[model samples]
Target: MTTAAPDLAAETRDALDADVAALRRGATLWTRLSLDQRATLLESIHASTSAVMAEWADVAATSKGLPPGHPLRGEEWLTGPYMTLVSTEWLARTLRTLAGGGNPLDGVRMDETAAGRLRAHVFPGDLSDRLIVSGFTGEVWFDRDVTMARARAAAGLGQRTPDRSGGIGLVLGAGNITSIPVADVLYELFASNRVSLLKVNPTQDTLVPVFERALAPLIEMGLLRIVTGGGDVGAYLTRHDEIDHVHITGSAQTFDAIVWGVGEDGAARKASGRPLLTTPITAELGGVSPIIVVPGDWSEADLAFQAEHVATMRLQNSGHNCVAGQILILSEDWPQREAFMDHVRRAVAATPSREVWYPRAAKRLDALRDAHPEASWSDDGRRAVIPFDGGAADNLEVVEQFAPVLGVTALPGLGQDFLDTAIAYADERLTGTLGANILIDPVAQTRLGDGFERALERLRYGTIAVNAWTAVGFLTPALPWGAYPGGTLDDAPSGIGVVHNALLLDRIDRAVVRGPFRPFPRSLTALRPASRGAFSLLPKPPWFTTARTGASVSAGLTRYRAGGGLLRLIPTMLNAFRA
Candidate 1:
């Protein structure tokens, strides 16, 4: 079976060139939208997303081998239309604040790091956030060189002074997470002050129309455009004369291919500093994310709770997440080490089998399996894990497995000694400086005290989450998500720049998010039965394999987005525990 070659006619290049020119012209008009106008447009978008997710989820679910209205439909809704609507809501608030003579961080807490970075504790924005994600907090850290005064003043630069001569920017969207492309577009449109041309990935190309409908205001105002095609179209756009800058979300290999060319030619081009594409690039590339569990004396319940937490982090999106904990580091000397491992195995075994939805995931899985013949294929035959008894230095330590396969490596130490060793292992051995997570008992945290805080400060990842997966850092619309900000264009380890920053801080370095070790719903150690009742606010995250909620949480969420209130929330919560 021979595949046909891609169409690369001169006419196609000419058409794209003309489109780019038009978008470049439109860029000047895009910034003309007043802050109020922009907010109104975003509000319209938020309204439209309610309708868009219905069609979007159907296509996404069919492709992934799930029924259109199945529980798994929640994944697309949450990551797609639901997320875009949330971003629009936040951005509108931000723009409104900037429109007035007010700062967005009116009541947000702030503290100076010993390392000279100004950390803004941005989460728990309101009472709702506090009640919903109780004990969950997130902070955004500015670059070391940035001053407190400057950081505050730098927020909302795009809205303060619109770019009259803004240029068209290209976004090479990721196929995995639906919200990612929309997030990148928002960053370009509102934060970076550019007219965005979002190139939908071929795998999820069907969603372009849904996106067009969701972002209708932007499209109508000539602030955005969505195009479809394969690598040929992407290559054309990357090299197009009118594309002033670009942002991509994908693998580092793909980044290299875009910046340089392919094969030996690409190598020579990179070395000679004469690449085919000259447009400045900012990307979010995949990394070998690490999760470090501080050794602690734990009750049986503690082990089980943390085990499910870790398992959920891996199983989300079938481990296709770029920041999913690919490598889990534990303390060999911990008394509960064996027990925790047993619980982890049990938790994963309980997780139902899922289809390999992400493209090329099966191939990546096979490679990892072939690479590590000793990988344990636990029950359900759903997930596989490779036990790493070897030292810190190994292939498993450096490479990212974009599949439902993880590598577990344990080290010998206690307290800060264990933390220091674990941090160093991840900082050095992990492939890229994207994001990492740390799980420490509160007692251990207090014992480590300043040492623990300092250890977290020293961690070099772009985003660090304490007692939670790093996704929370990314999900917080105000916190910036990207590689730590100091990499060069020639060699960006996890790509460059930041996105999802509603405040629009000029010099964001990284984000830090902290969650309670045991939150509601999964309160494995909660003594009071009433403490567990807080789970009624929302259904268990339907993305979790263990969430067997028979009711369509996705539809309920959509209705809620379109204004369902407590009427819809009641059924959603009741149905969530059925699993």
Candidate 2:
């Protein structure tokens, strides 16, 4: 006899229920497994992922409108496989420390500043970190209140407590970054000590197979299950009694909808202090991230170098990154302000535009332009430069355009005074406290002296990078990536909690990252040399909007991912040189 056709809603509910049950079953084994068992499984997972990175990246790239073997496609490799592998390696190191060292900081070195703040030097922690990205440095700045004793006691708080047989976590994956769900699943499993029922985002349904292949080891262990559906499945899983917790990476609005209800009902539920979903939730949400370029006696070269750097932030991935600089805080009083702006305009115009692959991106871009038509560069319609003159500052600062739109807001002042005003602007005006960057030339740094140090202290952000994009903070597995803590279910500006924290610190205030004032070869700052500087320092990155040789870059990156060490490095370098 043939079975009756399954009802769509009923089937979704039943399927999600089974997924939760499987996760619960998988978690039971996790609770009883020793630390050694967890470490060994992670090692196995590492091997599984490493084995299929090239194939996984190729498939993922193709899904994102980037053709296979295209140079720009390497962006997929870096964000997808490279980042996942790095996160896995970091967790493995932590597991070893937790199991073998007895102390989480056994092999790690941490120091306290005179101000009584604990600082853990994370970047360039080893030879590989030093070799791959030279001169890049970052540190975890523990909250000022966290005393040394607390820092030590809370290093591995998750481990300090006995397992309460934690249940399943429903991970609502992000549609943008393909690696987010993979990392989220692993983080839930190893970091938070929970089994995961990962619901793939509808936007990236094509990547489910790659995820399955990479996570086969975890899946077979019954510790993880990947599910796919639309809102019905997500809603069922979110409110299901079996799910002990929910973790999501999306907008703050989505977080509210899941926690409360939607529209006036959500507002009423939030006001009444009663949420539909009782399970605890942690999230990593987007923010209107700012980049404050401190005014200084910058040379023509400095202005050119920073212009390309800034453009790369806004144009990378068609400017879909949550960490991309949303507002450009420039100094009105600086003599080079106009000159620097010229370079910015030139750079943005010169950079090759990519297709708006994101859903509703075109509409969003149109809304931003409609909201403010006095744009400096909006002729292309896709990419724009919104100038925030004195009167229009409010609209520019508050609104976060997710598309390739740049908003420039000029503050009046110079030196520490300018930096102080910019800091205040970010703290009071900006909506979220996710990530912010300060691009201060060494000349400016030296001029400001102790004032520069003070400005760093006052910037209220989860991560404050000097002369670097905030994305570096997000990509660094050792660094905790999240908003500044202290967000409630009622109001989560940048969301709460952190991910990719290898050390497993119980508390973190922010991460301070510093990059070189100038990239490898000074002349290469403008991207295309205007008859000056060095000829070629290194190959152009695939994500650079100006990149013309994506196909070759893709091939070299594939070879590099396929255990092609120095042998592959030479060809990649040559390809970069050619680009």
Candidate 3:
């Protein structure tokens, strides 16, 4: 039996080695192809991806315990196939521009923030985007030094140089989301100009067949390879000689395990700043995301809508998302603080109970419950809300509870004062810097004016979603998603680098995504009368866990995006209206 084990290990090593070698060879061929050819390849991928959307979403939903009739099943379609399809189409458009010898961001609106940071308005690319998400907007904020000329020069694949050499890139996929791996692979191939070998997390390996079908164009060209295995296989590929660069979407511990050794050896290596692996790496590690609520004179409808919004931020995908809101920071002096808390509880209770599908979810929840014995929980124990005062809740502040758990804490002051303190606390206390959200009344924001933007500047996070969940930044392919810069190998908090940046901009500081403060009809009345353009036809987003018609709406939106044309949105709009 021992001999057989060695033989099997040897066989696995040989297969992985062969795959890496193939990617190396494909990388060279990939570089030799013209921009036009690459664009054509991406178009083929989009068509192929569309063909597998239904089956792909189904497999993902079933594996995550959201069956066909399940209320949260819409999450599967939106997060899985819909996101992948939309991103593919957008990327194809960018590639075509490069192929046509035109700058991808040629006509893109560029502006500067209060602190002189360059920002590129990426979303609402056309009428379709404006119609699809309505008032939703996305912007990519570049580093302070990245000027307009420099950004223009550096944007797009092979824009500065028509021809470029490429290498083999290994992507370590996240287990929680099916679209993450697919999107990572696409970013590597299209954005970085590298042939990729995707190592899928074993927990979601059931989607391997679907991935193989969707990405068949790249697979057949040897530009991409997908493999599924446990940590041993990941460790093997991370250290493999043929792999030139690596990208991962998982936890900090996993990143540490790869860069350093495990256990005492790993600790010693980390302390000494001597890493085991020398390969260049980029990561999107999970963090304890914060939701900072600024004091405001909110109407009854606004309170109820924002409450559901907070619930959606925390409970989406059953809180399996890395960008899920883990901490709720409220102003102690805010008159509506208690009222908002009550509304949040009711919204959470109204949402259906979802399975805790991720591994060790119960153990993590138990740990949080043990830390805060005063925490409140749902009947099924799948959800919990732990309340703490001031900054005494160190346990909740520092821990990245990757489950349906929320830690609510209040700080002193109101308005700008409260915003300043909340921003400072989140920056200093939160475990990671991946993403954060701020909910403020639109009118209150106008009153605060520059103070609000300054607060945004002060908050140290990669993505800041104002009145929207940070997942919006993730779902949008145009935004660069990762940690704030300056993370070293030894002291990396949320890992390093960004992915899914379709425009391929360099030196991105962060992404700021804004959504309407209210849903659809409510949004029209909720916004200031002067800013009518900020209203959207979008009702409650189909991905919301509480949406009654999520499944049908999400499926319809996918078909509409996958080339079903404007006619496809007819039924989709109908389903959305029902939602």
Tell me the TM-score of each prediction against the true structure: 0.92, 0.91, 0.96
* Candidates by lDDT, descending order: 3, 1, 2
Worst 10 residues of 2 by lDDT: 529-538
The residue-level lDDT of candidate 2 at 294 comes to 87
Q: Give the per-residue lDDT of model 2 (tens digit) for 1-579.
A: 001222356666667667767777788888877777777777777778777787777877777677644445767776787777777777777777777757666556688654557888877567555534445677898987887678777876555542655578889999888788988887777667788989999978888888888888899988889888887667767777778889999888889888897899889999999987688999988788888998877778778778987887887777787788888999999899899989998888877645777888788887877877787663367788878764634655665566788888898899888899999989888878889988987666767776777677788888888877787777788888888878888878888788777777867988887776665565245344332122224344444555666445645554454455666566665666565
- Candidate 3: residue pairs that collide: none
Candidate 2 lDDT (Cα, 0 to 1) = 0.76
Candidate 2 regions off by >4 Å? Answer: 1-8, 69-71, 160-164, 390-393, 523-544, 547-579
lDDT of 2 at 2: 8
Clashes of each: 0, 4, 0
RMSD of each: 4.0, 4.8, 2.5
Q: What does candidate 2 score on TM?
A: 0.91
Model 3 residue 499 CA deviation in Å: 0.5
Which candidate has the top score in lDDT? Answer: 3
Encode model 1's per-residue lDDT on 1-579: one tens digit a residue: 002223577777666666676677678786677888888888888887776777876777676666654555566666677667667777888888887777776677888876657889888676545543456678888877787788778888677787454488999999888889999998988877788888999877878878888888778777787888889888878877678889999988889898888899999999998876777889999688888999877778768877877877787777788878888898988888888888887877776556877887788777777777888775444477778775646776777777877789988899999999999988877788999999987667768877888888889999999987888777778788999777665677788888898777787878988876654455443344433112222224454556665326645655565555665666655564454
Instruction: Please state the error at residue 348 of candidate 1 in Å.
Output: 1.7
Ranking by TM-score: 3, 1, 2
